[model samples]
Target chain A: MTNRHDHRLIDGRAVQARILTELRAELERERAIRPVGRLLSVSIGPSPEIEVYVRNQARGAERVGLPFERQLWPADITQEECKRRIAALNDDAEVLGIILQRPVPAHIHVRSLQSAIHPLKDVEGMNPASIGNIVYNDVALAPCTAAAAVELVRETGLNLRGLEVVMIGHSEIVGKPAAFLLMAEGATFTVCHHMTRSVAMHSRRADVVVVAVGKPHLIGPDMIKPGAAVIDIGINQVSAPDGTLRILGDVDTDRVREVAGWITPVPGGVGPVTVAMLMRNALTAHKRQVASGWLPPATLRGP
Target chain B: MTNRHDHRLIDGRAVQARILTELRAELERERAIRPVGRLLSVSIGPSPEIEVYVRNQARGAERVGLPFERQLWPADITQEECKRRIAALNDDAEVLGIILQRPVPAHIHVRSLQSAIHPLKDVEGMNPASIGNIVYNDVALAPCTAAAAVELVRETGLNLRGLEVVMIGHSEIVGKPAAFLLMAEGATFTVCHHMTRSVAMHSRRADVVVVAVGKPHLIGPDMIKPGAAVIDIGINQVSAPDGTLRILGDVDTDRVREVAGWITPVPGGVGPVTVAMLMRNALTAHKRQVASGWLPPATLRGP
Candidate 1:
């Protein structure tokens, strides 16, 4: 039904499904040996948008046969109280992973809460230690969205070694972590941020361009090299000319797709893969916990 | 006596002297209120080369009025024993900072030992948490060599914001951390490594180029843009044409300097500044320890 030579719209849903399928089998096999623990989602304050994320994560856990829980704390909780509760969660054997929902109360320091979560149980990969591990090339656990972007790039079947990648954002979570992940894969990348004089000048010369700057349609066809891969990680809400609200990515997907050899359509691209990555990280946390003796290891095989 | 327009050889000794002077004054003021602690250098084995480093660090500490001690463990010391000793040192009130010398024994897991050192006492900034802190723009404590490269660039009085820079090599301690440090200063940088297709192509377009790969004379005049600043962090020992051994930097300094507006000579460049950074980190560690209540706070002066 589609031209084979035409730009391949990288189906993120397909990639997510594939990864979830593999994880489901692995989780099923591991469940027989040990009792897996539940993931606790800690929401400091009320934010309607975060609920969407929590629901998606809950669904991903369900699909993968992992237990998940939602804990909503009062909006006015003090930073000390938040950290105290997280410390309790860290010591709980049944709590294999802790997810701290973002946009906490004005007074609470988010980084402090993240630091409180034990590194082994940092399923979201937000802890400073988790991020620092990427520098040493220990990236088995990394931020979900950043890991997802790399996963999608891998799905394109492009060799990462020596790949010239232009990462157009420098955010701590996504852009920066993604750059380190690419570096681990031996890709040479240039990180461009707001201060970058000409973002297009760098992007046009890359074999791959990853944009996470949160600007709708910031990248267009003219900025991409023909046959290059484009991974759009930005999710911005914009209003249509006819007064309708819609979600858009940093790239002008429609036009850029014509030039890109492979392109990720944002809503269906990085988002689904991100949720999948969270589920994967949760499993990794379980394995690490068992290995660390915090949780019981698998029983010896039958003689 | 010298041409005003000629390439200025950035003096690392001058920078080191300036930093040490400022630190001496600050240390004198702090010492009047509270007693300072000593730095402990942990050498895993008997490396003749490591003694040189230890001696330099001790001299730097003496100049700044901080106590310094060297603790060399047996070459065959178990990894567990090494960590146990480090843990003990971490708890010692008199021990302000810990430095883990490199080229550790083949049997010892160096990173595990480094991890054993408490973050506050990690004056060398080799801890994962310290390195990770750079991503969040908290760079007060970072790897000494990486920080020195940045300090040298600052010495040139160049505006870091939007500065086009190229970093050659991607070592964990030097090039990688330096890139993050540059990112914190709002510079857009490209990291080139062994896999880079054309290192010169990236270097020739930058306002600044920092090279840390240990291959002597790896960078030459053709790789640099005129009037650019070059910070060479490599320290390599090579046999000269006369069969004499000498230390050389990654850049062909003599030829490259003609094109570079500013350059750091091999032995007098990153090495001196690196030792100064260690002393500075020791001071930072002492302050942090005081703030955390691990040590007594400074007494208030008369109103």
Candidate 2:
């Protein structure tokens, strides 16, 4: 598949459209009983950057006919405010899946705010319970990025078991949980973080290397196994000749593609799948809460 | 320092004594305010094989003044009966730790029995809650064997971080949890189970090798790196010329000793430390229960 596999590329827009089509019917069935199937994403501040990202997801949810909205707050929002809003969204039965946008203002206590999200509404799996479930290999809602990581490889019809997979980062969102998920699948994995002394050496040995470190083009051709599969989860911004910036992946695309058998370009690869996962999360949340009262509230649907 | 360090000849007895001493004191204090702390181990039938093993552990707990007792059922104890007794123990608070002696016929519901143990009293850390905590890298209790493995290696005061440690076998009691613990401490770990293709290649590459497969002298001098640390946690029986049985570790200590810089002798090494760890688990259980106020009913309390 050419790297031109734009938005619908890896799991491209078409596959996503097909997925959304399924979710829409279930969502309408959900809204038939309840007023609406709700999905509230917590976006701190109206920075055009984060707002655009949130809007893209909102648009994706809308396209699926699943009603969704972004609860935007100031960038310098207080921990109390962030948590209160998340709790409010959680309490609202209409709000099924809760998404807390990343880079949630470094100083605003995102870690503490994460708990404010009820486990049921916690579609992103940021809460400790969700994280524990991941470690225990329990079938609960997993973190979105981790979900995306799994989808990226699995969507390609690859079996991960017994693969020497290397995850390059330890951030709870993308790296750590992904490693645990991979481990639970019986894949041999190693987690290399900032303190990892020989990350390149380690990466070079992997049959599949999944990089999530938000560093622009940190990995090159020499750091990969020949014909290895690479998924660049990181999107770093850099300036162009016109002084305008563009998003670049952690892997040096041109150089890595030579050695990598299968590579996901930054723009067209993991991005579309992640949005699909969100819509799926919302659909699942709606099914559990409004559709099937048999599904317990202590899981799945959460902020 | 000697390869002949004995399980009967080590500080395990001393540690067990200290635990009893402390438990006795605690018991007295509890007596002053509604007393009882006893432990009952249900033994299936009179299999001398299982007897000897459970007896050693029972002796350790007895030496510690745990008010230890054993209830024996026939060797052909039915699954229903075993399940009934285990459920009874879970309801009986006086029984602090329930060790359904191993070698219980394989057809029995082992997972069911394990799940029956109350989380607070699961000193062995086999309870799902404790296992969940361990997976989360939480400061909760850990399985005795795994804890002993860590304590045995950490006793050397060696920095485990950055060490290439290889663990053989994947029992929940020993290998799996030990690997997770070591990984959390930043040790690079590789696991070889029954299905592992090349044990020698993995073992030879290990800087610190933990073998607990219970195959007599399976790991030899040739399977180790020069000056590497060898921790032999396995205990297997071999026949003597007199037609007597002798317990031996998986590592060929006589020869491996010369090559290994540090090693844990079969009898003296992990076994006694395992008992000590069990005692620690009991104390840990009490502390967590008392601190959290999440203790179960009186039926689950100690005598």
lDDT of 2 by residue, A16-115 (tens): 6776788778767655555554677777865567766787788888887866777778877788777777777777776677888877667787766776
Q: How close is every model to the real structure, measured as TM-score?
A: 0.97, 0.73
Clashes of each: 0, 26
Sorted into a CAPRI-style docking class, model 2 comes out as incorrect
Q: What DockQ does each candidate score versus the true complex, computed on alpha carbons?
A: 0.81, 0.17
lDDT of 2 at A142: 75
Specify the highest-TM-score model's number: 1
Please name the candidate that would achieve the greatest DockQ relative to the true structure: 1
- Per-residue lDDT of candidate 1, residues B1-303 (tens digit): 223345478888889999999999999998899888889988987898788778989989988888889888899999888878988899999999999999898898888787788999999999988888888788878999999999999999999999998999999899999999999999999999999888988999999999999999999999999999999999998987899988899999889888999999988889999999999999999999999999987666797
Instruction: Kindly report which residue pairs in candidate 1 clash with one another.
Output: none
Which stretches of candidate 1 lie above 4 Å from their native place? A1-7, A241-243, A299-303, B1-7, B241-243, B299-303
lDDT over C-alpha atoms for residue A12 of model 1 = 83
- Candidate 2: tens digits of C-alpha lDDT, residues B77-172: 678877777777777656666665665666676655665777666777775545645655664678888887887667656787777788877665
